[model samples]
Target chain A: MRNVAIIWKKEIDSYFVSPVAYLLLTMFGLIFGFFFWNAVSYFVIIGIESQMRGGGGPMSVNEYVIRPLLSNVSVVGLFFIPMITMRLFAEEKRTGTIELLATSPIRDIEVILGKWLAALTLYGCMLLFTALNFSFLFRYGNPDWKPLAVGYLGLLLQAGGLLAVGTLISTMTRNQIIAGAATFGVCLLLWVLEWVSGYETATWAVVLSYCSVITHFESFAKGVIDSKDLVFYVSLIFLGLFLTSRSMESLRWRA
Target chain B: MITVEGLTKRYARHVAVNNISFSVEKGQIVGFLGPNGAGKTTTMRILTCFLPPTAGKATVAGFDVLEQPMEVKRRIGYLPETPPVYPEMEVAEYLRFVGKLKGLSGANLGHRVDEVSNRCAVADVKHKLIGKLSKGYRQRVGLAQAIIHNPDVLILDEPTAGLDPKQINETRDLIKSLAGDHTIILSTHILPEVEQTCEQVIIISQGRVVATDSVQNLQSGTRGAETIRVEVSGRDGSIEAGAVRQKLEQVAGVSRVVLRESSPQLAVLEVESLKGKVVRGDIARAVVQAGWNLNELHTAAHTLEEIFLQLTGAQPTLEAPASGEKQ
Candidate 1:
């Protein structure tokens, strides 16, 4: 555990020192802020907020403002997750530092956990910046605090799962460009599977959607907390880390 | 102390390291000598617990590399062929990270980081980012990381592989200074480096242990040891060289007798005796007693290059078993 913390601390500092982290976080914040503003304007400009007084629509200002914030975060996630995860192990292998770490007394699993925690820490910071929308909920409009808190919970789990999965892909290659491609590909597959299973007529696809990042996030994103959904994301985080450890074990011999 | 027995590492159809066995006792600096691709790095990796052998066992400080890898890792410091470095971190930060991973903390970790930095001569660049440092400094930082924990066994694979001559000499001296307290196993194909830096040499060839001995023993065995050469001639063929050798064998301290290469009539022989046994006077008397004329005697000199070539490349010269013809 200390080794993991040591690795995490160094990695976090390294990320901040590099320009890449700052650039990605800045871009993610802008995109998220835009999504929330769009949701506010959509309800007001379409006269939907006013017309839904009798209809079963988002009549409250809180639903109009907060649901928009959570509604499109899942989509915005498609662009944001890969940036935080691209450098987990691929860069280490390319620079030859992987040998230094692998030969250390620390176990392979510990290294994986350390790297995942590092990336997730950055992702967690990125999610924290979205708090602006939450504050706006209580300020300029009515807000359903329950769904908003649940939305943030779903966002954290979705980000954790994607980070773990993306890190596993990063371990499979040395080129950052290739790691980015593979990470983006896997995240896209999981996200798209959610749509195919839940939105389309495929029953088995829907079953697999349980593994999709969205399936677990949907109920929680709407202010509903479910243990099974949390389990699915936690299992993913563990499974991704497990595969990463195995990849490193094989790589030790190859190197 | 470290022992590797029948260490074999195969990659699919090709064997990177074949069955090889050797040991390094406590406080001894052993040099692993071999040409490129001779499994010098592979063997070091196995001992460092970085890679498990395909079929063999290795122990470091009494811990099995396969069964107790972490224990083996804790006891050994390894420098790979290429220095593993994180470019963005400063030298001090990098060393601190390695020290912490080695289970060092607080004042002890701080002291170790400082100690290794000063030892590797990386103190000046402690605050500079490793990526911005020179290649030599990077190598030193790598050495710093390896020794930060003050491990019992230090495994350096090609420590001077790509250094300038001046840097090589400095690194050599640094490694030499480490011999008394650290059990070091360093590998390099540079012949003279092993001759100068190590007391014992283990030469690996084609993934096998070709020779293991003290530097002096290996030198003497592969290339004939330095010995006095004697030339002799008979005035009237009064006595044969064989007669002279029989008499010489009876002398107080003569050990070996052989015919000379200059001429068949002239006998050149090397006389080895127990330490402190002087046979020069006895040899002269024996030659005179056998009636053989002695012309010249001088100790033969052979360089280490010849010895290394013979030890590393001594394949069986195929010839007709009964034929006496020279190929």
Candidate 2:
């Protein structure tokens, strides 16, 4: 237990001590900021029609800002969450420090949990930075708090699911570059399922896509906390963490 | 104390260490001598619980390595050839982390960190990042980390391998100081290191125990060959070489006589004997009385280097590695 906390503290220290974490944070902030501004400005002046035909469009700023945020956050999240998790075990293995940790008195599960918790903590901080976008809505427009809160919950759950998938991919290799690419590939593949048409196939795909992280998060974005959605994210986290622990054990023996 | 029995480690095709076993009593500083790929590291790893033996048993401080590895790990301090250190951490912080991992906490952790730093002479570089330190200082830091918890056994693999002459001398002195309190298994290909610090030597080659005994015992083990190296000065004159050979052969246990060299003037005799007593004293007395100049008479026993070469089949003399590449 004490060793787990020691490892956790060291991992969190590694996150902030390097430039990579800050760079990713700044990039995420900029993307969120740009989309928030564009969403609000598009409908704030007069509606969308004036620029095209001098006839006003029906969508209001709330429709513009809130609609894009619900979807765009999911898209933005797909990229951001993986970047945060790419180095978890992969970089440690690459550096040979993983061997030190494994051979220590600490158990394999402790190492997996400590690192996973650190990655999740960093992702949560990244998600918090996205809240600044909603701040703009609160100040300039009268945004409905319930829907926005629900959206935030969904984003939180989605982040949890994406973080798990990212960690699983990182467990596969010692190369941080390969881990990053693999995590992105998995996230991209799942996120793209939403584009496929036909309600029957897309519905099942959407349901699976609800397992897809971004899809389940979409439900909360419109103001609902589905227990099924919560359970799916929790189960994915458990599965990912369990596989990570097993990988650590296998690698330890092999070494 | 450590006890090992039938320790055999095999890879898929070849055995790295085969049925090799030795025991170290408390306070014994045993040096492991072997050539490269002689299974020195593999055997050490097995004893340290870093690798499991294919079929055998090992116990450190009475805790079976297989059944209680954590207990073994707790009692052993290992420094691999590369010294597992974080390049980013300062020497002090790294030691502190290691101490903490080894179960030292609070003021005890601080005290141990200080103690090890001073013992290893790494106090000056305690605040310097390990990557920025020189090879010698890095080695000291590595040693510091290993001994921070004051383990009962210190397994240092070539601890002085890449050090300069000054650092090598200092590290050797440090190890010598550490001897009685900690049972140490210091491995190296360097023979004199065994002579300097270790009371007993265990030489492993090609995964087999080629030799294991005190330094003096190893030298004297090849005493069966009854050849006494004798140097005599004789010109064209009075003394018969055959007469000296015949008289020396008459000694009890003196077996056969083979005179060495084409130079008749420089008569060197190699006496083969079943040999009761060494008989060199008697032979020397007789040779002098016979009117032959007895220049020198020395009992020929194997030197440590010769024994090492003969037993392990390794080169007796290897060129010292050029300075910069030693690192």
Instruction: Tell me, by DockQ, which candidate is best.
Output: 1
lDDT of 1 by residue, B1-327 (tens): 899899999987789899999988999989998776788888988898888899998999999999999998898888987789888998999899889988899999999999989999999999999999877788888888989999999999888866777888889899999888999999887778888899999988889998898987776555333355677778675346676666766776555666555345566666665444656666776776666787776655344556666767754332221223110
The 10-residue segment of model 1 chain B with minimum total lDDT is B318-327
How close is each model in CA RMSD to the real structure?
A: 7.2, 4.7
Q: Please report how far candidate 1 places residue A238 from its true position, in Å.
A: 1.7
Clashing pairs in 2: A209-A212, B253-B275, B255-B273
Model 1 chain A TM-score equals 0.90
Model 2's CAPRI class? acceptable
- Please write out the lDDT profile of model 2 over residues B31-103, one tens digit for every residue: 8988777888888877777777888999999999889988888888888777777777778888887788778
lDDT of 2: 0.77
What is the DockQ score of candidate 1, to 2 decimals? 0.61
Task: For model 2 chain B, give the 10-residue run with minimal summed lDDT.
Answer: B318-327
| lDDT of residue A253 for candidate 2 | 45
* Model 2 lDDT tens row, A153-251: 777767777787787788788888899889999888877765553354645765664545666665676677888877877888788878877766555
Candidate 1 residue pairs that clash: B260-B268
Off by over 4 Å in 1: A46-58, A198-202, A253-255, B227-301, B314-327
